[model samples]
Target chain A: MCRAISLSPNSVLYAIGSRSFEKASRFMLENGFSPETKVYESYEEVLDDPYVDAVYVPLPTTLHVRWAVLAAGKRKHVLLEKPAALNLSELDTILEVCESNGVQFMDATMWMHHPRTAEMRALLSDGQRFGQLKAIHSCFTYKADDDFLCNNIRVKPDLDGLGALGDIGWYCIQAILWAADYDLPQTVTSWHEPELNQAGVILSCGSSLYWKDGRIATFYCSFLTNLTMDLSVLGTKGNLHIHDFAVPFRENVASYYSASQFRVPIMSEHSVANDRPQEALMVGEFASLVVEIEGNGSKPEKKWPEISRKTQKVLDAVRASIEKGFQAVQIVS
Target chain B: MCRAISLSPNSVLYAIGSRSFEKASRFMLENGFSPETKVYESYEEVLDDPYVDAVYVPLPTTLHVRWAVLAAGKRKHVLLEKPAALNLSELDTILEVCESNGVQFMDATMWMHHPRTAEMRALLSDGQRFGQLKAIHSCFTYKADDDFLCNNIRVKPDLDGLGALGDIGWYCIQAILWAADYDLPQTVTSWHEPELNQAGVILSCGSSLYWKDGRIATFYCSFLTNLTMDLSVLGTKGNLHIHDFAVPFRENVASYYSASQFRVPIMSEHSVANDRPQEALMVGEFASLVVEIEGNGSKPEKKWPEISRKTQKVLDAVRASIEKGFQAVQIVS
Candidate 1:
């Protein structure tokens, strides 16, 4: 939904191959896109479309690598949603293909693009305001609907990846990583509610990330919960809080305090909606990237592998913690 | 301090043999109690006093059993603050002494007397409001003050009693046990932060309790944190939330909701001070108990060992979990 709407004005929408071409055509038409948009009945048809300069692969978790590789084979830039792939190996494969094909590939993590989040990161990182970052805490949770149990991609581990952690925890993992300037943690210990479908699939999860400088990050994610998105960072001098990151009009406020004193009115950032922006501002950024790719051969932005690998490492540690019932799991990197 | 303030109206202060007599006298005078108020510095001096019919033992955690037994042997009713003792055997000793001497002993858990908490318990247990409770989640954390750390009795394994779980976590444990109608959990699993010191005892602690009927209770306690007290319970029909049990006035609201639909407000029994009146209410309850003991024989309203033993068992399991690091420890009823 986001991809079809985010393309440049002159960009062509090359519909991807799915189980039903007519349904895909109707989807495009309903969303006000031209019905004449090239509709591919198979994966090869979409890849072979010469007019298609970029592909937005919102496929199942397991299919992420396969589709990204196929898109890269056709030299098409790609935007993949969270949990880039099932594991680091698949992520590595996607990265290798995209890099070798000279195509721009980026994970659609819109959380970092949110203006409120940017403001928070700035306050926490600025040594004058918060000093050295000490700890990061986050919680992202929401109850799933009825169909979520039976046919949802999230429940199907092979498709949606890991349960709660992979789906929502990736945001928390990214939050900590981004706050610490992508500094990977050395150790991770986690605990998960055992009633989850499998040992690895958690209903509610908690983890602690230990960094080299004695800094730590703790996070909680749950599928069976009321909707909540909260991020808090404590530093030597002060602290920063971002209330809600996922929603546009949600109450997003960042506050910094020193020596137990409120310093100023909490800075407020209002999210700008480009059009049908449901998930993240990343859609707008991805749209800009498409223009950049069309104008120049490459983007000056950071490469995909650098950030994707860091996220993959956190996800891997989180998985190991869940499997080990939250014993300290070493981050190989 | 609580005992002296509670007995202020009686114009009599009983100081058991533990601290210096001059020190007790100075403490009483500093607190605005009359210096002439009877201060028997020794345990025998206080017990032999015809005016001293009750005792409040704020001794070390391990000495609770010994002092309570001695007070009971002297036919003095007792109000002993938590952890009850180091173990169940000590509690048994106190119980036998009280029974033989015909003196009453009650663990001083003031949370039970908080009017709002009483209302919360009734609403949840009403069956029609919350149905059969399935789960309870609680957390209590606070950054330790300098004085608390300098005179850190809680750090001493035998003196301060149990770490976070025994001191602050005991409140959460009691809340769960009371909510579950004293039905002990069949299995318990726990995790504790590795570091413990005088300045910061336990960084973070979590315990999971599993009952025979599938009811689960989970709680977290930390001394190295900003103050937070929150509790939530989920049942078959609806859910209940007690924002802050210890200090009810600090945004404490209890309500039951089903499927996003608001039910009737779980009526909170409003005491004179519904806000942060826990301290005063605790003093009043103890004073009333003192009056009951003086008016009648030593026996008051409830026995101590029954509740103390159950709490100790839970604390023991939490300690085992801390030692085992994520291993489930079964509670032997």
Candidate 2:
């Protein structure tokens, strides 16, 4: 995030804070933050700085509600990392505060801001190329080393409680929603036998989502499998396949295949050669939204918050499904 | 099947049969069959021909038990097209007769005979490269035209019976089984709300399979979506991804990607330079087994029959899960 802000034209590494002053200073120095960037001893001090326009929260899932609300209370726009609050109610509280604060709020899903994202979206939405979508499957998995598995915050119940579901499943769910144009599924059913750590944090799981029109989406997320980001969107006329949906091949290189006639793999010809990296673009996008409200006195865009809320709602439903022994949980608005 | 037999070294298009003599003659004419090929009006005449050592049964699921049983009874080895039968009982009946007659039995799942299949199997089985199999997702889908959807034999409950599940889902289920090294799942649960034709035949459906050790697999098969054959086998160390698992790009071309340590895609460098197409290889394989039985008095191979039975067992479990309101159906046997 610090590097992204440093590279973002609309944003800057204005202030950073940690529990330890030395750690904050070290982080700033190591990340090449300018000498002018302020390093605060405590998080509240960062929010207390009246000159700060927006704050990016990279705290664990458990701390999102508290710090996000506090940051919003300080009238600072919030750019929060994903698994934004553990559940929908907590997210709603933070979003409500941000709404009342008249500050922009967006989750830091960097891939959303990538040029390839919009290019893929355009192809998916094209009637001639994709037609009506019938089904979607997105999976994001990576092998977590023993050290990380045993000690990572993701496996701690009170920290990144949702574990792999929150860490990588967030991308799978978001990709599905993005493909479906954010129409929430009518019901969510977690597939049976999700593996959980000793603390009961999910290590791996899968689910099936059903819409009213028979359009379905399935996703699997795991911390135990090799890194795999496979997103396949099936339409009536063609299908879009992305092998590296979560992380691009290189920092800036990404490509996909569109197989319309089943056997024939049509590699997408045009590569997205964007100069700015995705993280920088994401920070730029969030900061520009903040600028709209800050300089133009415009309202915070409702779209981002709505998307976050829908994703949270579905996550909550999945949690409920798992809790209820893998039954289908209806998603009531 | 006729074409495959013609290309096989041990097999020949010795006899052709249809309901009408002219239809059989025209088929032989169109396919460039030798004038020595006997055109029979009745299927029984071809089976009755003592010179014919094997029979390829491409009949619909409804006729599988009848034709395959009759063929086996006449001491002709049976190469049945898949969804081997409508139900396990039917498949079992066919298998029993084939065993009694000492005739080799094999399902014509062409991809299994492809050299790429064995190459991928070798890769998946490698402990260092793939580790223990963790999860798998396979989907085989294709769009059925309007006329075909309404008039096709597959849509009729009395004909293909299982519809899309029997036709395409067979490939998906078999692929999942293959990736798991033919270990049947402890339980199977069908995903919710399958689209059904007016005759109550499945047009699209999905299911989850679970092993006792927490290995899981899911598959979706559809007749409503554009042609999509995606098979992803994820293990701890690396993952194998095949975009066209069911049908290759062309007759004899196929490839896969293995992305180990997450983002690094390691495509297998050496492509299998097999000269024969998958279907021809399938017939050649089946015919060679029959030759061993005929020339050397070898007993019918049990491996092919067992694989067909396991696939049928899972299919039956999936069907039961759906019938029981998507409940988890235990595979007791």
Candidate 3:
């Protein structure tokens, strides 16, 4: 909802496509969209729209690669929902298609654009404050909706990538990776509840990721939990905690105390208006890219296949750990 | 010094054994003790004191069981420092000597006596407040002394029990066990950093304990960390957090938070005072046992050995997990 509102000013809603055109038109009209915005009964009709410069694909997880590829082949930039594809093969196919057609492709992982994340990264790197980073702990959990069990794409393994790990675990993985400055995990292990579903998709997962420098990162993600989102980074000198990295409006800060006499800071909400920005910033970056392409012909933005490949590898190892009952998987890289 | 002063009214300080007895005596005198307290030439003389009703054995960890057995033979109640003994065999020997001679043997694990602990426990068990207890998380850690490499007992495997597990990890283990009403842990796993003389002792440990009724408790304890002592218990209705369990004088309190609101009562300093009460209460309990032994010829204190044995079994499994590099160790009843 926030993304649509943010992008509406610069980008026209070319056409609203759903299973029913009447419902799509109603949604568009209710959101203050123009009446000229065409209504398409099928996704194919929207793909056929020559004026459509980009496609925001929010379909079920299983159809992401199919629609992304179709949109890219039609010379349209594509922004796909998380767990970009069901597996490595599908993600690779989408990447190949987008590259061959010279169209931009990006997984809409808004957490990466959060400004507080950038601040945390800078804080960890600053020797005076954090010193050498040693470990990271992260958790993202919330209760599943009632409809989650009724043919929901999130519960389908072939569609939703790998259950909880794909839905919320991906954010935790990305947080740890970015905080550690993209250090490749040396090994990974995971544990999950077994009674959830037939796809053996993990509903809850706890994973340990080892880095080459002997640093460790642990994360937990669950769909059967009372909502919680937290992150902690431990270093030699001090530590930083983000109670809710998803919406970091205020955070509690503490440093290592060295003296007996110290003043207690009044408990006040420390607001960083620009501290942690959300994925909506990506729309602005995307807008800049559009302007760059439309105004002056410049070199294209750098593609991130390496990051995608590494992320998929970690995801695969985490899933393997869950299948084997949290057995440790030695990461070759 | 606080522990020593508590015993002064009834027991004579026959000897002070240290690299410098004068310095030790000065420390005692500064804390409101008489300078006439005997300064001993050796620790053996203190153990040899016939007038002593109890032996306050706070010697380096390796000497705990040796002195404890010697004191038990001399017919003195033994107040031994924690990590009761290095292994099960030594603990058995200490217990056997005390039992045969009819002397009281106690481990100085005092956090359980804090009043706030009882308050927190009551709040958690109240069906209207927190409902059924589901999970527990705890941590206890502090910075190592500068000369820890050369002089610290914690670095020596024989003295410090294992490493962090024996030194500080025991506190967390005891906390979890107490919160669950002494339920036996069904499984355990741990991770250790052995380079810092942490052999058989985990620097960082994460374990999941499954009770018979499907309740799960998880904990983390580390020695290679800044000072922190906190516990959070999740229940069906709400959660209770006992912040700073180890240091009650330092603004520690019990907090209860439900889905909609939270409450934190200002705790009086004496509410959780640690000084004298732990030893005084335990001694009072033993005094009652002494009366029962003399009058009814019954041995109610016999349950202490059983509890100690159970604690030892869990400790052994945690050590095994560290040796196997965090492999899960199932506890067999």
Alpha-carbon local distance difference test for all models: 0.66, 0.89, 0.63
Report the lDDT tens digits of candidate 2 across residue range A156-195: 9999999999999999999999999999999999988899
CAPRI tier for the interface of model 1: incorrect
Where does model 3 exceed 4 Å of error? A2-4, A7-15, A25-38, A145-152, A192-195, A248-270, A274-279, A293-309, B1-20, B34-56, B72-79, B96-106, B126-137, B192-221, B228-245, B248-311
Chain A TM-scores for all candidates read: 0.87, 0.97, 0.85
2 versus 3: better TM-score goes to: 2
The 10-residue segment with the lowest total lDDT in model 2 chain B: B262-271
Clashing pairs in 2: none
The regions of model 2 sitting more than 4 angstroms off are: A261-270, B262-270
Candidate 1 Cα lDDT to native: 0.66
What's the true lDDT of residue A213 in model 2? 83
TM-scores for all candidates? Answer: 0.77, 0.98, 0.81
Q: Tell me the tens digit of each residue's lDDT in model 2 across B1-333.
A: 778787889898888879999888898889888999999999999999999999888988999999999999999999999999999999999999999999999998999989989989998988888888999999998899999899998899999989999999999999998998889899999999899998899999999999988899999999999888889999998888887788776676677777666344633334565688889999999999999999999999999999999999999999999999999999965
Choose 1 or 2, whichever is better by lDDT: 2
Candidate 1: DockQ? 0.12
Worst 10 residues of 3 chain B by lDDT: B260-269
